[model samples]
Target: MLTAYLTHPDCERHQMGADHPECPERLAALRDHLLVKGLLDCMQEHEAPAASDEQLQRVHDRAWLLQLADQVPAEGYARLDADTLINPYTLRAARRAAGAAVRAVDLVLGGQAPNAFCAVRPPGHHAQRAQGAGFCFFNNAAVGVAHALAAHGLLRVALVDFDVHHGDGSEDIFAGDERVLLCSSYQQDLYPFRDSHPPAANVVLAPLAARSGGAAMREAVTQYWLPALARFAPELIVVSAGFDAHREDDMGNLGWSEADYRWLTEQVLAQAQASAGGRIVSCLEGGYALSALARSAAAHLRVLVEA
Candidate 1:
């Protein structure tokens, strides 16, 4: 089966502002690089559908969903928090972004695709169960995990997050759910600082200090993430893939490179191959610097698309 590349044009319409880091151009940059690298040719492309309210409710509060729908402005931008903003198209974009993750899970689990990658916007990882923050209107990765567990009757799912910022939203949504194992790594004392403690026994966190290079990340993944993932023996693997840790990206202080992303993808692919029938659904999260984001994402996709 081919690797699936999922996205939606609506994702490009959810622009926060001119100077905002999480701009629509991020997706364009990634696609341009993947095209230039000939990576798109090897993959199957799919347009993401809008996630249903039922799927969204699996990971987010129903009240919060209503609040977001009511807050969508007819013309200008509405602020969700200090960093998150929504324009007229934000709701549709957020739905598509989240839908890409759900569709990715469906494709991988149904055997239509060996694996899948979602290249959408409004990076999720910080939004909590009842709140929208950190440029995320919906918790996309969490939505996918919930879909796998509740919709597909998956008993065990592993979520691996390598964003420079912690996946606090995922932690919040899956806090008491023992069916999901979350193995995450992030820069210490970064944005959305909620890594005080593991909210559940299934959550494993590795916080790296500022300026720590790829060596530290490798050690963390090998020691913490891999071990936890092996013990869980998940039926599906979900990746909260973020590229902002690249050295060229100033979004964070971590010193990662495109090669680091390649290595990380390889590791996740290995685990999936061993335990999950090579099923992985990766969703785009944080990655601000356009060039670095494109290069790192391409490196990661190359591994996913390789035969």
Candidate 2:
């Protein structure tokens, strides 16, 4: 089966501002590179549906949802935080961005696709259960993980986040849930400043020093993530695929390159094949540098498609 490519045109409409790093053009760059590399032809494409309130509530607080609805401006932008902003279409776009993750899970688990990648905008992983912050309104990967556990009856679901910054939101949601294991590697002392606290037993946090480069990341995965995943034997593997750690990207000081992304994806794919019937769902989280994001995402997708 081919990998599923899930996205929505509405994702392009949720712009924070002209100077925001999480711009709509990021999606266009990824799509353009995928097209140029002929990666799109190897996959099944689907337009993402808007996530219903029930689905969103699975990972986000009801009050937060209603607050976001109330904050949506008819024309201008409403700031959720110093970083997060909402415009007229922001809520709808956030729903579709998160919905892409849920649909990706269904597609992979239903055997319609070997795996799926969600190339949507207003990237998630920063929003926690009760609040939206750091340019994230809803935790997309967490929503999908919840769906896999509640809707699909999957007992063991693993979430792997390789974003430059720690997935505080995911960790917050799955902190004590033994059914889910979250393994993450992020730059030490980065944005949101969340490395101070100790993680739960099911949560594996690998903190890499600033400018650690790809070698450190590989070592972290081998020593920290792989062992935990092997012991957990997850029924489904979900990836919070963020490319901002690329050497060319200025989002963080990490020195990883496209090759690192390809290698990391291969490792995740091997784990999926071993324990999850090759079922994997990847959601975009970060990657501001357009050219590097495009190239790195294309590299990651090439592995997903086995191209």
Candidate 3:
């Protein structure tokens, strides 16, 4: 009946370092803002459960999963890559963050919730099927999409990402998968620095220039994403909601604002209503500046809770 809000306290314990941009405080700031805005009042909140190994393996290689598990440290941190590190609680927190998305999918598809928002951290989207990178251990949105198709018997699903950086991991995992449509928008010349190779038809890339601002993003969505999404007629919609592109965040130079995030979410919701039975599972991805992250995330949630 209401939007399902899923999170776990353990999500905050997985830290890269005191100075890492993907710190635990990102979640805390957004959560506090949501509470203060009373957005949580309109939603049904639930603590996220750990995703089963089977569920995670559907979207990730079992060997890679085992490797990540083995890398968890007992005292300090283990480096997964230049941009990713795992502390003692990292694996558990990553599992819970990913599990939140899976549970959100379950709740929405089972008629328990009209839609859902996963507020967990250690944001996922950059973690590919075989390797974890970009401050991510598991691809949460991909895991959710896999579950919707494999476990829930859904054939058509869509994932929408609006992070400042390309979701190369999501693209890697879902490329050539006709059953799912992946529409992503990111600033050009950003992190992960993917090549300009031809993407599969299922994966639509809308790369904006630095400081292009929200106008370019909205135009890309209108010209590219809407057409593809309409044709797919998806049964569910999963969102990789990121806010680092905001003008104040300074993570990338897309030069967006809270209003842009609000508008983007509104478009996603409209598409969901068109063919997905209003089913949505939105997960937190990238947002750095504490004040901006809090404000932008709160803006996104206002649309979800109200819709």
- Compose the digit string of candidate 3's lDDT tens values, residues 1-307: 7889999999999988878899889888887888888888888999999988998998899999899989999988889988789999998998998899999999999999999989888889999999988888899999999999998999999999999989999999999999999999998888989974537879888999998999999999999999999999999999998899999887899999999999999989998999988899999999999999999988988888888
Q: RMSD for each model, in Å, please?
A: 0.9, 0.9, 0.9
Across residues 1-307, which tens digit of lDDT does each residue of candidate 2 receive?
7899999999999989889999999999999999998999999999999998999999899999999999999999889888888999999999999999999999988889999999997888988999888999999999999999988999999999999989999998889899999998899989989864546899998889999899999998999899999999999999999999999888899999999999999999998999999889999999999999999999999998982
Clash number for candidate 2 = 0
Off by over 4 Å in 2: none
Clashing pairs in 2: none
Regions more than 4 Å wrong, model 1: none
Error of 2 at 86 (Å): 0.9
Backbone clash numbers for all candidates listed: 0, 0, 0
Model 1 agreement with the true structure over 126-166: per-residue lDDT tens digits: 87899888898899999999999988999999989999999
Of the pair 2 and 3, which is ahead by lDDT? 2
